[model samples]
Every structure is written in structure tokens, then in C-alpha cells.
Target chain A: MKIDKESIKKIAHLARLEFDENSAEKMSKDMSKILDWVEQLNEVDTSNVEPLTTMSSEVNDMREDKVGTHMSHDEALKNAPKRDSDYFRVPKVLE
Target chain B: MEKFSSFDEIKKSLEKKETDCRAIVEYYLKNIQTKAHLNAFVDVYEQSALEKADQLDEKIAKGKAGKLAGMVVGIKDVLNYQGQEANASSKILKGYISQFTTTAVQRLIDEDAIIIGRLNCDEFGMGSSNENSAHGKVLNALDESRVPGGSSGGSAVAVQANLCTVSLGTDTGGSVRQPAAFTGIIGMKPTYSRVSRWGLIAYASSFDTIGIFSKTVKDNALVMEIMAGHDEMDSTSSRKPVHPYSELLHFDKKVKIAYIQETIDSSALQPEIKENTLSVLEKLKAEGHEVEEVHFPLLKYALPTYYILTTAEASSNLSRFDGVKYGYRTPNAHNLESMYKLTRSEGFSEEVKRRIMLGTFVLSASYYDAYFTKAQKVRRLIKDFSENLLADFDYIIMPTTPTTAFKFGEHSGDPVAMYLEDLFTVQASVSGVPAISLPNGKDKSGMPIGLQILANSFKEAELYAFSNYITQITS
Candidate 1:
């Protein structure tokens, strides 16, 4: 339940977000509170319980594999805030 | 005379030309504008709605109009509709227009339902209250000071305020039901895969469901019938044949209803909510039906399990929104990492950032087993508990929310308190069972309360039948 400031920064990085120093301090406090509350689940006896993944007991409802036209490249790129003719433009990934 | 009390009334009026589609659309448009102070709609497609109405009128003239020929439906911003801004109430998605319509929305259009506009929601369906929306928080129709329960708050409010006949909302952990409870309407989160999620902006792919809010169970059932069924585009959509829901209500078979006494007895529940829910139970018992108390101990851990599973899935699903593709991007970033960080930081709201971070922490390599794995285990226990209980009970019932609608700022400062608002409702999402919130009665402050009815997976017909029966008895 003890969330360090360093951990908050790391979490932000992992989440692909940026947090200013003040926001990081606030997040540390809030994150600690949430973690503390969730820690209550530790007290419950789940030894006999199985972890749930899918909601349905039934499995394998997969559809037939079929090729279909999805959105065209132009249509897909239409919503991109920053896009070039052939691709969504972002700051260069490599230096 | 009573302003289209039900869809049936609207259908009759449209047939008789008592009110043309354009007039109905305009009337609702005026109502939506007047209620703009509530911030219910993100965008009102006035010209498009009018054009659609004209087309429907032409269809009516050709005798080809369907049951919902002139009815208007408000859509949640998360669902895609062709050429409309599917903002999802986030700065990250600001100015983004959908290229294709969601299957559910497209079906409504095929059945002649007019798309009035898009309703506001919490950014990416993150918050229990509407306060997290970039568009602005939606006020409860009944009380401006209180939240309309979210991330489906605007959808619920639009229906309650009669801006639209019914609205579509996506329920991921009580988004639809809780808001319906707050606004005195009916909301249904159908069984997973019962309704296709194609073109729905994914928040938590596994738990997210396309739900409906209406003034009556009949309207909800009718709208759901049109929208439910398999879609080739959506992998999770059910292949089962869609049934006429209204016909199921006529069956005279007695149904067994189960109430979670432990949940009812919880001290965390407000006294008025408890009282109102019990009164609904008494009403059910007054009718010639079976009602019993059942225990599902694993439900106590439902909220935590839901938070873990949903956040983990969200962390992955939202990864595609990395500013470079189909959403807001920062011009100042000199590198890709900074671009991703800056765009998201500026685009997403604080609540969204908090959830993304929490999701990252739980799903991170080292913590996955301790947090995510353990939560999934708890989720399995919860699902197993529901499965076991459903063997004996036909439908499970509980108070939709622990308390009635709270003031807008009541839990705004405390994130944990807001999350706890979902306690009574998360179990159904975890189990993927069909659940609905029906307005039970009013609290001490005269705000509406709701009773949640949950049934086994894909048993939506039975759930609707039970809900209809209950509504009849209570009325």
C-alpha cells in the first residue's frame, strides 16, 4: 500500500503518460489509498476459489475465418490527428 | 397527449401522421437545447437527424416503414456512427470522426430509428459519475446538483428528460444501470455476445456490453431485439437466433426470484435504498410468484476483481490510442516516446490517467501474478458463485446501487468512494450475466432508487420476462 513517488513515475511511463511533479505527488497519495482499500481482499480466504478469466463456462464461440474488406487506408487514417498520405505521422521513433 | 408515453404510442402517432418525424425530431431537439445546461449531449446532429426523418417519412409513404419508423434514439459517444464525431468524451479523441457505423446503431437505422445525437460519458467509460467526461459532467434530470450516474450518464439523462425515446449506453461495471437508477429509467446490460460490439470504442473488451436505457421495459426489449444478434465483424457476437422479446411476457409460467440477503443487509447500503428495494421484493411476493433469499459470498470481492480485470484489459485496448493514430497528437514532442507521453497526458483526463497508471501497475511484468492473476482468480470465484446460485434461482435480485444518487461533488474528491458506488453491480459484469436496473421507488429526498435483476448468461428473455412481471405488479 506504500506507493513511492518513483513508482508513480515508473507507472506513468509504463502507461505511456506524463505526470508533472505536483500531479505525481497527488497520484502517489491517491494510488496508496486505492491500493490500501484493495488490500482488504487479501484478508478473504480464496484458497479454494479458482481465478476467473472468461465469464461464460461455455467456450469456443469463434466465428468462421473469412476475409472481408475493413476500412480503407484513407478511411482509417481520416481520424488521425497527425497523419501523412500513407501513414499516421508521429514524432520519429528512432533518433 | 401524454407526449408519447411509450414506443407503441409513438408508432401509432407516426402511422396516423399526428406528428411527423420532422416535428418529433424538432421537439426533441428543442428539449435537448433547453437542457444544454446539463451537458447531456456532446453533439446534436440536427441536419442529419432532419434528413433521416425525411427519408423515414418517404419510407412511410411507400408503406415500408418499420416499428420504430419515427422514433429518435440518443447514442453514447463511444459508439461509431458514420461521419459523426465519436469523441468518447475524451480530449484524446477530440475531432475524430467514425468511418463506419456500429452494428447496433446501424441496425437501429435499418429499422427506421433516427439518430438524434451523441450523449456524453466519462472519458473511455472510466468513472462511476459523469464528472470525468472532457465534455463536462451531465446533471441528473431530477436534480441538477446530483450526478446522473455514469459513464452512461448522458444517455440515461436524455431518456429521463424525454430528449429521445430511448438511448444506447455501454455498461462496463454499472455504466448503464447505475445511471438509469439515478435518473428513474430502465437500463439493461444484455448477456455478453448477445449484442454485437463492432464499432464500439473498446474500454474493457471483455466486460464492455452495449446496453439500452428506456422509459419502459417494453421499449428496452423492442430496441434490444433490433440491435441483438451476430455480426461477422465482431468476434464475440452470438450466433444464436434473435427472438421477439415482447412475446415472452405473455407466458404465464411462474418464475423463481432470488434476492441477495447479504447484500441487502450490508451496512454500507443507505437505509432508503434498502427500504425501497425490500418494498419491491414485497411487491413481487404479493404476486403469485416465488421469492427467496440466496447467498453469494464471493460477491464481496467483485469490485476489486472487476477493477483488476477491466483495468488490465483497458491498458492493452487503449494502447492503440497512442496519439500517432486516429486521435489527438502533440506537436511539441521531439521524440516518439515524448509524443506518446505528451499527447496522452494532454488528451486524457486525470481519472483516465489514474486508471491507466493503475492498469500499468497491475499488468506490469513483476506485479501481474500478485495483482492481475489474483484478481482473475477472485473473478472466477465470483462467476462460480453466480453459476451455482443460478442452478436454484431463476433470477438474482439486489439494489442496483448501495445508495440513491449522490450530489455531483459528494464523492468527486474521493476516487475510492466513487469506485465503491459500483459494488452492488460489478458482479454481473464479472459473470457476464444479463442484468437490468428498474426504477423501484423514491428515497427520502424523493430521488429514484432501482432494483437490479440478474439472470444466467444468455438468458435475457427470462430476465426481461421477470422484469416485465415485476414492473406490472409494482405498478
Candidate 2:
């Protein structure tokens, strides 16, 4: 359960985050401590317990799908950092 | 003219034609301007609020006033207000505006409530103290040096300083109640799914709930009655029929109450707070309510279980904030992957990044069963234990927090210590049961100590009645 610097980097990459070497080392220590504390759950016997997904047992309300104006194309892209015409602009993916 | 102390008092004055909505808005706006040091408000809709108040006054003149006439409400940064910035107190969402309003806030507007502004909170509702906010830490109105217990600290302080008539906050794990406890106000987190989550900026999807912070328990009741109902947009919202919670404030029968023997006697509890809570229990018993001690051994697991599940969900929910559509984007990036990584690293604060990393590690392929799955099962155990206890006892009483509000830099060094602040308030949330923290007593230093009361799920009316009864007899 020990989280080394390598594991910390992997987790950061997985979460699309970045940290310098010093911060990554700090994260490793902090994550290790938190994991150790949360390990207390292993002491409980939950062999027959079900994993809870939702608090209430109510079924999702069913409604017929209908298309309506939610936000105009311009409104939807209003907050984009980089935009070209009507679409979001990202770095080229294919050569 | 007498100063209105509560929202109900304001309503009465408006009814008597003594004060119009415009004057009430002006009074609140002036107070907000004066109390700027508290950092309780993020955005104040001064012009819009006055305009809304003028419209409301017109309605009142026409004898068509709604239930929440002239009430000035403040919303946390997380709830969407359609065109207002819902940054969730995080820099990542700096320029993002909500495309639509949340069902809960819309309900308030429908009742003629005037939204004065957005309140500060922990970034994405993560931290216990308001220090995690990208905006800045909210100071406790009573003690400027002490931290306002948060992610709802600003909401609580707004009501505490009378900057607003009432405010709405979200509680995933003690966010509302802890701040309320610190500020000596009333905060209620109703049954999970009791309020719609469609427009709330997601922190932990399953556990996040819209709660109310008010000066009076009756105000919480009235707001909850208006805000609770199923919304087509939020699939998780409960289908339970909403009730007139304010009208059901008469607790005629003696109620059975149980105090967790472990919580009050725990060494972590401040001596003054423990004494105050025990005294309140004794008074409740003397007031003819059957009260006794109960043992809940699983109490220690509640904090760990809450953090594990919530952080995991937060990590997943926050993944949508990549540099694609909205939110902050990094200035320097060569590829799409680097863009996402750099954007997130630059945008998120330290506490947020730490949590996201922890969540990613826990839910990783190598440790999914050990951390994420195990935590889920433990959550089920805690839920069952709470339900069984509530089935026998009408209510469970406990101290809202182990201590009163902590001074700044007290527990900021350690994340675990900050997580421990949620120990008492997370069980009711995990169990999806309604819980309220009332200002029952005060500590030796004159800071407030909250008395937390718990009732079964969808039993908010009973919760309101019991709280009102206690308030009536005790204060």
C-alpha cells in the first residue's frame, strides 16, 4: 500500500494533473498517510454487504426523448479558451 | 422601524405594510457593503436585486405576494443561477457561466425570493475550512482570526452577519453543518436526493446535497418545503411528495432520543463542547423526552468511508474539465495530453490536486477492490447501522463538531486533521437521512456549539417539528 514517487506520477498522469519533483514527493507522503488511515475499512467484515450506488431506491424517471433548444451553438462555445468558427480548437491529433 | 431579525420577521413587516421589498433589499445591501471584511460574498447583484425587489413590491401592492416575499437569499458558488458565474470557488472554472438555473434556486425565485449574491466556498466544496477557496478564506464574523468552518463558511457567515436574510449551501460531508456550527447558525442537510443536484457543480455526485443555512430552524423548514421535490433534470432527485414542513412544526408527543456514548466521551472532543452537549441532553431529558446512551462502534469508520467515496467520485466528476469546451486552459502546451495536464495542474489548487491524485490512486486498476470497493461496502454498513438505530430511537443527538471553530493555521498543516472535522456529520449523509445542526449551546470562549439531530430518510417534517420543539423549550 506504500505509494512511491513513481506511483504518484502515474496517478497524476491518470488524473491529467502535473507536479514538480518536490510536490510529487510531498504528494507521495500525503497519499501514503491518507491510504494508511483509510485502510481501517479492511477491519470491517463486509463479505455479504452490497456496494451502494444510490441512496434512494427510486427508479430513474422515464420521459420521451425530445429535442429542443437548450443552448445555441454560440452559447455552448462561449466559454471555450480556443475556438475556430463554430468548433472548439485543440492541437492537431493526426499527422 | 424595528430591524428585522429573521426572514419570518421581515415577512410579517411586509404583510403589515411597514416595510416594502425595496427597503429590505437596500438594508441588506448596505449591511453587505459594511461587512466586506468577512469575505462572505463573492458576487453581489445590487442593481438586479433592487430591480427584483421593486418588482416584488409591485406584486405586494397588488396583493399577489408569494411565500418568500422580500427575503434576500444568498447562494453558494456551486449552485447554477443561469448566466451567473458558478466557479465553484475554483480558478479552473473562472470564466464559466451556468447555462441553466438549478431547480432549487428556481424554486426560491418562484416563491418571490430575491437573490442578493453568490457566497464563497471551498473550491469545488472540498475543504473543511474555507481556506481552500481560490477566491480567499472567509473569516468568521464573530472572531476574525478564526476560520469559518467550510466549504459553506460564507453561506453561514452571511446569515450570521445578517448580510442576507437566508442562504443556500451544499453539504457533501458536513460542509453546511460544520460551518453553521462554527458561525452559531442553523444548517440542515435534508435526506439525500431531497433537493435536486442537476445544477450544482459536482463535488461528489452521490453524496453532494443542497442544504440551507439560516438563523432559525423554522427558516430552514420553510426553504426546504419550497425546494424539495423531484426534478426531471436530476435523475437522483427523490420522487417523494413534498410536504408543508413549516406547518408541521408542532411536536405534541414526547420523542425518544439516543446520544452516542462514544462521540461525547471521545478524547478528540473539546472539554467545553462535550460538557455543553451533555448539558443539552440532560435538559432534553428533563423536558420529558426519553433520552439514553447508545453505542455505535462503527462511528470511527464514517470519516474514512466518506472521504474515500467522495474523493473517488470527485475525481471522476472533475475529469470533464479538460481544456476542451470551458474552464481555464493553460497557455503553454504542445499536444492535447499536455494541454489537459498543464491546464489542470495550473487551474486546481493544492488541496484539489492532492484529492484528485488520491482519488485516482484509489480507483486505479491495482487497488480498486482494496480502496474504492471496500469503501463502498463500508458505506453500506454505516447506512444500515444508522437506519437500524433510527428505527428504534426517534432521533439521534450528537455534537455537530468535536470542537468549535478552529483558529487559522491550527489544522491546516494536516489534511487528516481537517478530515476529522467531518466525523460527526457524515453518517447522516452516508445514510441518506435528514439531519439538522441547531445552535443549542455555546462554549466557554463564547463561540457556538451545535447540537446535531438526525431523523430517518424523507422524514424532514418530523425533523423540523422536533427541532422547533427543542428550540421552543430550550431557547
Candidate 3:
């Protein structure tokens, strides 16, 4: 519940975000305030309650397996920030 | 050409050949140009809109036009419109053009509605005020110093300024209704799964809903009718039959109404807002409707639960934008991990980063059950409590916001204060029920107050009819 510089570093890592010490301090304070506010939920007795992930009453939308049009390779690759031909180019991963 | 208030008037004029579609388009285009200072539109589709108008004029002549023929609409930046940018007011997706149109927007197009433009919004529909938009803050049409209430600020202001006949906005947490309230327009958020979320730039998949903003209830209902129903693209869209909501606006019988006693009497509520709400309730009571005060003790917890779950979903949803697939990429990365870190850090704004980090923290291995899972259970409790209230009462009524249109920089420095803006509006989002913000009246400062009304899930028809009735009597 206590968010500090160390916690911000850990969370920033998990979230793939980066912040310098100053911004991280600010973020830590903001996050602490928010987390503390949300901690009010502890007052409620949720022991017997089932976690509701979605509000939709219906279940899975089943369908017959059939070939249908989808985004072509070129169309899918059209928005790539860094693309080499058909593949999305990124920083060398295996290095 | 004369100014038209509703689509009904426009339809009448179109049929009589007094006002053609081109003329209507020109009228709105003029307004859009005149109100450019408001920063409502991210990109205006002027050429395409004019072409659509000419085509619709031909269809009108042939008497083969669709239901929304000649109706011009502005879509929120968060919803995708094919071949147009849907950046969601964030620099991260700065120039990203949508490959496919959103199901909701496509439905409007299928019914011959002209998409005038993509309006500005909070970055990925995150903020309460429109200040978080990278495009710039949308100025309230009535008062330039005040906010139009956001993440759908531009959407609300578009309709408010008559730049479009109606606009489409996504309400993750009162984005549509709150802005509508702020701008003195009608905003309605239909039940969860009522409208397909196929091409919506996801913030929180479960909480997000495509909503309508219009000057009139009938326009809102007409747009809702066209947009609602199941779509194969969105598995979450309900299979329930869509209603002709515009046609069912006749409400003859009195209904049971429950006003939350705590909310109306809360110290957070502005005096003018509380007075307007009470006056509306009194008017309804005078009209012979059964109105009673009820207690919703779980109202305070709805915001915390909403923030927790939505941030978790946003962190997951936003992970898709890792620089390689689409959107902004960092030029300073030499390694894969640093690429992600620097790209996300530089790409996203501070608020977005905070939410993503908080979401990661809550969903971290150590605190998953305490924050994420427990909040979900609390969410269930809140939803059940809301549905139980609606089971007895025909409608639950409250103020759309704790206050009216607030000044800019008022809550900008404090994220918690800004988050608290969704105080009165998040219950419907949390419960997945249909809720609407009808213009109650204006405050002393002349800013609008909204009377929010919620109904049982899938009861959009009832909600629209009652809203229509209220508008008729009150206006």
C-alpha cells in the first residue's frame, strides 16, 4: 500500500515505463494517494462474493468454422512503426 | 437555410425539398469553422462529408434513403473510422490511421449518417476534463474558461455548438453523460454489450460503451437505435433485439423513482446542483409519479472499484502499443527492453504512465488478491446493490456530476480531485446498466446541471421514453 521510489521503480519496470527520480517521486506520491483512496473497499465484506469480470449476461459467441476474409499480411503490416518487408523490425532481441 | 434543432425537422425539410443535404452540410460546416477556437474536432472530413451530402441528396430524391439520411455526426477520437486517424488524443498513436471502421460508426454510416469528423478526447479516454488531450483542451462553448467535462469534451461541445446534429462518444466512466451535463445537451450510455465495441480504442474493455450526445432526446435515441445490437466482431455485444427507441418516446403512465438520499444531501454537491435536482424531483412528484428517497451506501466504493478495474484493463490493453506494431517509437533505444521502456515513457503522458504503473502495481504478484480480485468482488457487490434498487424502483435518479462546469486548472494539479469528478456518474458504468444525463437546468453561473437517471440492464427503451417525457415536461 505504501508506494515509494523503490516501488515506483519496480512498477515502472513491470509496466515497461521509465521515469527519472523526480517524476518517480511525484508518481509515487500520486500512486500512494490513489491506492490509499481505493483502500476504502476493505470495509466491505467480500468473502462470499464472486469476482465479476464482465457484466454481459451472455457467454461465448460460438460460430461455425469457415474461411473468412481477414486482414492481409500487407494490410496488417501497414501500420508497423519499424517494418522490414512484411516483418515488424525491433531492437535485436536475442543479442 | 434555417437552423434545425432535431433530425425530425431536418427530415421534414429534406422531404419537402426546402433544405437539401448539401445545404445542411454547409450549415454545419459553417458552424464548425466558426467554432474552430473550441478545438472540438481533431480532423474534419470536409471533402468526404460534402461528397456524402451530395450522394444523400440523390438518395433523398429517389426516396431510397436510410433512417439517418442527411444526419451529420461527429465521432469521438477514440472510435476508429477507416482511413481516418483515431489517435485518442494521445501522441503515442499520433498519426495512426484506422484500417477498419468501428462497428458503431459503421452502423451510422450504413444508415446514411455523414461522419463529419473525429472529435478530440482525453488521451485514451482517461481524464475527467478534456485537459489531458494532446490535441489541446476543448473549450466549453458557453464559457471558454470552463471545461466541457470530458473525456468526451469535444463530443459534447460539438453537439452543444451545433457543429453536428449529434456526436458519438465512448463512456468508460461518465465520459459521455458528464460532458453532456456540462454542456447542457442530452447524453445517454446504453447498457453494457448493447453496442458493439469492435473498433473502439480500448481503455477498459468491460467498462467502455459507445454513447450518444445530442441536443434532443429523439436524436440520441435514433442514433442509439442505429448503433445498438450484436456484432460478430465484438463477442461481448448483446444478442438482445435492438429497439426503435425514437418511436417509443410516448410515456403515459407514471413510474416509480428513487433519488439517492445520501447523494442529494452530500456536502460535495454544489448548492445550485442540489436545488435543480430537487426541483426536478418535485416536478415529477407533482406530475403524480411515486418518488422516494433511497440509500445507496455502496456509492462511495463505486469510484475506487471502477478506477482499480479499469486501470488494470487499460494496462493490459495498452500493452499492445509496444512501438513495433503501430504508433510512436522511440529513436533512442538500442536494446529491446529499453525500446519498450523509452518508447512507452516518451510516448505516453504522465497520467497514462501513472495509471499503467498503478495497474501493474495492483496486479503484481504480491498484491493481486488485495487490490485487483478484491475490487472485482466489491464490484459485484456494487452491481448487485444497484440492480436490487432498480428491481423495486422503476428508475434511480441522481445528479450527473457533483458540480457544474468547473474552471480549467481547477483540478488539473490533483489527480484524485479530477478522479472525483466521476463521483456521481460511475455507478451506471460499474453496474453495466443504461443511464442518461438530461439537462436539469442551469446554475447561478449559467453552467448546466444534469439529472442522471439509471434503469435496469437492457432497458434502454424505457430509459429513452422516460427521458423524453422529462424533457417534454421540463423544457
For B1-475, candidate 2 gives per-residue lDDT tens digits of: 4666688899888878889999999999889999998999999999999999999999989989889988899999999998888899998999898888989999999999999999999999998889999889999998999998998999999999999989999999999999999999999999998888988999998888999998887888999999999988888788889999998988789889999988988889999888878888888888888999999898999999998888899899999899889989998988888899999999999999988888887888988888899999999989998999999999999999999998998998899999999989999988888899998677777889888999988899999999988788778
lDDT of 3 by residue, B1-475 (tens): 6788789899999888899999999999999999999999989999999999999989988888999998999999998888888798888897788899999999999999999999999999999889998999999999999999999999999999999999999999999999999999999999999999999999999999999999888999999998999998988899999999999999999899999998999889999999989998999999999999998888999999999999999999999888988889999998999999999999999999888988888899999999999999998998998999999999999999999999999998899999999998999999999999999989999999999999999999999999999998888
Task: Give candidate 3 regions above 4 Å deviation.
Answer: none
Evaluated with lDDT, which candidate comes out highest?
3
Taking all chains together, each candidate's TM-score versus the true structure is 0.97, 0.98, 0.99
Give the lDDT of residue B454 in candidate 1.
Answer: 93
Q: Residue A74's C-alpha lDDT in candidate 2? A: 86
What are the per-model DockQ values?
0.68, 0.77, 0.83
Model 2 global lDDT (CA atoms, 0 to 1): 0.90
TM-score of chain B of each: 0.98, 0.99, 0.99
Q: Where's the lowest-lDDT run of ten residues in candidate 1 chain B?
A: B1-10
Deviating ranges (above 4 Å) for candidate 2: none
Q: TM-scores of the first chain across all predictions?
A: 0.89, 0.91, 0.91
Candidate 2 on A11-88: residue-level lDDT in tens?
Answer: 888999988999998888888999899998899999999888777657857877998787899888888989987899
Clashing pairs in 2: none
lDDT of each: 0.87, 0.90, 0.92
